[model samples]
Target: MPLRSIQSAIYTTTMNHSLLFTRFTVSLILCFIASAAVAAVAADKPNILIVFTDDQGYADLACYGNEANKTPRLDQLAAEGTRFTSFYSQTVCGPSRSALLTGRQPLRSKGWGMPASEITFAELIRNAGYQTACIGKWDVSNRKAILDRMPNAQGFDYYFGTLGANDGGRVRFHENNEPAGATDDMGSLTTLYTDKAIEYLNEKRDPEKPFVLYLAHTMMHTIIDASDRFRGKSAGGLYGDVVEEFDHETGRLLDVVDDLGLSENTLVIYTSDNGPWNQPKYTDRKKGHPEGSIFWGQSGPLRNGKGSCYEGGYRLPCIVRWPGKVPAGRVSDALFATIDFMPTFAHLAGFDVPRDRRIDGIDQTDLLLGKRDTGREHFYFNNAGVRQGDWKYLKPDAYFHGYAIEADRKKVDELYNLKSDLGEQTNLAAEHPEKVAELKALMRQIEGNDPPGTSPIQIK
Candidate 1:
């Protein structure tokens, strides 16, 4: 038959109409399959477990640079993950924790340190239909107002741990509002919190939706009841014992996740709230950070220890581990502050953090995933130390660093090459007058909302 004649015949009958209908059905089926595949890829969100430590130093973990301390678990985590070299925190507990949870500077929050207006990281994670829980210290407020400023009030489905009122009255462990279990008065509270976290991981985790577990351990913070497993078993003395104990707990969490087949799908971040607090204590107590009069944490060449805005106090270790996604056994010197956690996590979970308020943190997801080289250019630090990038432009002066060391330095201004001199020993203001002025200008721009010279407490 001729081609045109055959075509005409094929289109003429009821059978031809049925054949066309079958063709259309197959095309629709293929389209549906393609869409389903795309959806599956889009829905594979990773579970986030941010392990925030209190008063941990830049050289606290074996993975980062601690020579005397033993952190086997953390070392292994780094071996299997990327370690952040230029990670920074707010330099103190309450304020730094606030920034991580809220994605904004503590100065903007208005309640002194952590304040109240900000939302928790758990809350943001919860909003995305993920299971959210904060299982550790809730030091946003004092003892009385703890529940009001609780992890639940902030965004967690559940809140465990303590409502610490500084180092003296810091609570040990609580499951929800009640005490987790009554341990001996001098018992190590860090282990209790860790145990609670593990319990939550085993029991509360729902497979249908991903979970956000904020394991804010008060490990090195205090009530220095060393874990039974690590007591007197490290090279760095008592401080090493505390760090090692915390590392053991970390190992347990990671092992639990791996054993349950959740390791590949989970993203774990290990960081500290601030630098170690080295309060002068002439004696070792039966419990807590109070036991050690002097802080044993090594600043690793950074000037001034915790409670001040020097590199020792503000800049600390940051380690991230995500199987197959984050680079394994790698180091990135990208500068990232604790405040970037919310934006980074939100971006990973396929959403944007709200731009309703000015956020100091940039989405550091690229830095975390080893995709970006340089971290955020400018970050504000003001938990006893206020600095903007290379210029050591203190909020008004540089005595703040001296204040933490309990010495009264003259109200002399300072400028240093942070890249070349991380210790901040040499004063560059006299030599590089132009650079000092440039950094001061940069500080004004980066500060955005913080007011300068508000506090009147001088070191001298």
Candidate 2:
């Protein structure tokens, strides 16, 4: 046992300790990566952002193949989430908003057709502890006398923008109902909605609570108003420039989410209330620059334009992005209605449907998660209409000049195999008489035909 032996023993011990420490550190790193992957996989809850536009078409988005229109931000959003091919909103403003709120068809609620009855997504989400905010257009039950049935009564903590359609329609705004100075000599309504929303995020957000922002855009469906910044920006027309401006403002919201570190946990939804305004004719006041386009905003082989009971009136463009969940850049052809929004939002927020409350929307949470197929195979449309898979059934007399005309004479009346005749040009009622009877029976059954206030349908 000499000094050299002692030195050799001491060196071997130190080297062994170093090797052991290295292995432990590597193992810890691997565990951290595995944990992160699991968290990504299991992160189901999301901050909901329902981005609703005024009168965009079912086929108006670049992602939806509206080659004429360019929506780079929305396109990028689509690339990161799910795009629904056959989403729906009402042909007009109020009813679509109503159906989305109550989870029931507009016809079923008091403000069913207009706005002033009861219930809303804001109320429900707020009950579930979400910070609910409605931007752009309220368009329904916002009047002071209608408090019991208004957005605040229904559950929104923050509200902004016009309470109705165009500022020309029923001008109003609220910073949580406290009106602020217009940001620009006229900022676009789109910019104001986004700016106020960002301010809410900056000042009121707790970082721990999930938020539900209902952005009801007043652009592209207005007095065709635009800020000085975007007065003339696109090739489509002034309306096209306005739409481009709308798209740019959307980019700002996206940036805010990224900057605020909310992107990963937020579910941003983009859609329109319905398709274009019946391509309004141009007069001086009607300058008609923003009346949407039959020339540019295509319904992609769908029958008819807005205001008609055809696909254009109700069918809409829908895109959803939840960073860590939902398949990215995928298109979904799932049949969803305005009525379904409430239930979907509730489920995403982890709230339960009240048993006493007659919730009409089926909880398609599995569909939203991309765990199920898109062909929902079931849904009821506005104006006593019904669509089950490829066969869309109108009540033979279900025309709605405004939105809910009880007796529509030139109604398509029969059913069309949507897969074979999506344009709905043919009448299959005679050949498939049995199918007609079946669908007609369902329409009456689901509607329950209070049969007192409106149209009557006692078949022969």
Candidate 3:
């Protein structure tokens, strides 16, 4: 044990310690860089805000060819984005919401019978690191506020609205899973829902994380009313009043997005659940309202209205705006539907669609971004019939929700060239048996052994 040997051992130990410290410092720097990179990628993900309205007609807004209703905000939205001419939802409310959420046809999603087992787009997008909130009418829980099928259970981080429609001229509210009381002031819904949504965007959501805000308004449906300020102010009557108020409220929400500087990176989709209740058979029932008879929405030139298997029953007005990303002032006639949102969100949000269940939605990211002109080549009308290209074939005895005329109840297949007859006025099933057979076969192939009529659900 010489002094020289002990000193050398001490020096070697110190050198080894210094080398380990240097390596640890370098590893810390690399880890910090990796974490920063991950955060940057997450921040770059775009926000998705879907504003869904109930029972809005295809030509409800000025941009959609309405001459009476003044929807300046929504018209500006259409001017700033692509207005889809051939967009669709479902023939009714519950089924349409079900299709949008699950991306499956109502027959498979079971519409009002949608089980807790069904996976929703919110579930998928939330899993992909997006903060999700639903701040309005959520009718998919069979309008009963079934806990497991409600928004909170369906993967929304925050839920603040009715679990059902305001069908009885009243709606009960829920915040997350807890009851938040009820309100019968149907007129206040549009602004109230918009306020909640703006609050979520400003206060509830994590600014660092991308988000999905689904604001489903409960206006323009049956038992419709408008705020005192808007009541009786439109040439389109009470329905127009409701629509104009909706437009203004929607503008407020969009303004919040702009103020927050999320516009360029946020994809905003405005659409409806179904066509308006324009049929006299349905409107006549609302004749005894205290504030005069509640008028129905106009279906433009389209035939029939909600609950029928005709163009007006399913077609809707859709405006998609993503500044600089989606072309402005573009009017697209390509076919699209609420069912397509699930898969498209999956693609844009970077999540895989559920592999176990059948999803009927096609990824229309290309169509949305102006990369493609055409959309889905074929769309099925539940079990009623199918539409391919310009030809739509309705099977004999096509199901209608108690609004079909005796003349339309004929026991023969009806076919129409939608290109020439957007109203579906011309029946060509006799002359073009080939097109009818082709679409019929397509329906049979897509629907399998499912029954022709929707599974009966009790409507309030």
Candidate 4:
């Protein structure tokens, strides 16, 4: 009860409290370190970024042998990744997007508007705990009732971009199903999408979770629009300007990934939905309509562009960059398609492919990693024909050359060895009638296997 006893009790209490606080602080630091380590380990699973451009041709970039449109960033991307010499996508926007998202031919899935019943790559990756985002042109379907068929309902955690192409005065834009704005000014669309993507990498995405960012650019399609910063920047006219702007925005996105230290772990792929819309059909070009020539994109040495079943229509330019995993500056003439991305990504991310439905995509993990050279052996191009090995058989009236050919003109089955005839100029169908029959039989087999509800295989 004396002063000395009271002081001794206070000292004891203070020392006890100090020891307890010190212990708590040390435990907190340890827990923080352990959490950081766990996140780092999870990051090893790698993130995915798909830079898909609409209507971009195989020869659109510098690395693809284009002399005019100088896409330094994309050229560098090709240099840092594996560039595919022969890649395929659907002949149109909606089908191509559907194929990439679902890993099944549009016919195999439910055609244009990706059916709600089909699974998507985003859904597959999401099941593995990854953050999935789709930013830019999502032209799967823009119809009101099928609006849910857009990226958000399909599986994207966040969706920002247009529902269709930016070819008209007004492009429908949305931010996760809700309307963002309908803008006639297409100049800023690329910047908006790219900035949003960078923001996702920098802020929106959970740092501990791997992410799938599909940035589908709207430029390089019809009525090409470029930002003011890229006007008159190249020798290829307005089309060049638009492509260069896309390249710049792509560089900005890559820079952000590097800044965030995600470059090493991110699998970045740059490709197109289909070949360029070089010859847009105009039954009558009245006053204000967009001139196809002003925004024409080249398909290089290939015979015809867009809308055609020829080499130019669906043969795409694909670049895959994964730092040490994918070989740098490697050019592969292997056969791969947009439909293969779902299974390939699922394979790389250690996820399971949807077992309930039939997926047409084959895993190309080994092919992309440079362990092998070939990917796909047979690819069916909508109405074109079946391309197995080097043989391609065209249907009697399958080739649709946009505005170049008369719609009612009659044609015959044509076959070509793609390995020797990349341009498809020399038709050997008459010479090798047996080969043509084989391709026709394969086409018939594929059609017979088509899931119910698919439109009858349209050969004409």
Off by over 4 Å in 1: 1-43, 110-116, 169-173, 177-187, 279-295, 383-391, 395-408, 450-460
Q: Write out the backbone clash pairs for model 3.
A: none
- Please tell me which model should have the higher lDDT, number 1 or number 3: 3
Candidate 2 off by > 4 Å: 1-44, 111-117, 142-145, 167-170, 178-187, 280-297, 402-412, 449-460
Q: Give the alpha carbon lDDT tens digit for every residue of 25-69 in model 4.
A: 999999999899868656667799999998888898988999988
Every model's TM-score: 0.82, 0.80, 0.90, 0.88
lDDT tens per residue, model 2, 1-460: 9999999999999999999999999999999988776455335557888888887667666777766567899889889999888887777677777777777666675433444445676766677667777776666663332555545666787666655565343355555555643432233577877888788788876565677888888766746656777766666665666677778888898899899888888888888877775443322234333444222245777775566677877888888888767789788888876677676776777676544546567666777778887544566665556787778887766755653232324545667788888787787877888888888876776677543322222111
Better of 2 and 3 by lDDT: 3
lDDT of 1 by residue, 217-322 (tens): 7666644546567777778877788788888878888888898888888999988888876644322332344454233576777876677766877888888899
Question: How high is the CA lDDT of each candidate model?
Answer: 0.70, 0.68, 0.86, 0.81
* Model 4: lDDT of residue 230: 83
Clashes in model 2: which pairs? 123-154, 123-155, 139-163, 390-418, 396-413, 397-408, 399-408
Lowest lDDT block of 10, candidate 4: 451-460
lDDT of 3: 0.86
List the pairs of residues colliding in candidate 1.
222-289, 223-288, 224-287, 224-288, 281-293, 309-385
Greater-TM-score candidate between 1 and 2:
1
Best by TM-score: 3
**In model 3, what lDDT does residue 337 have?**
87
Instruction: Please give the RMSD to the true structure for each candidate, in Å.
Output: 8.0, 9.1, 5.1, 4.6
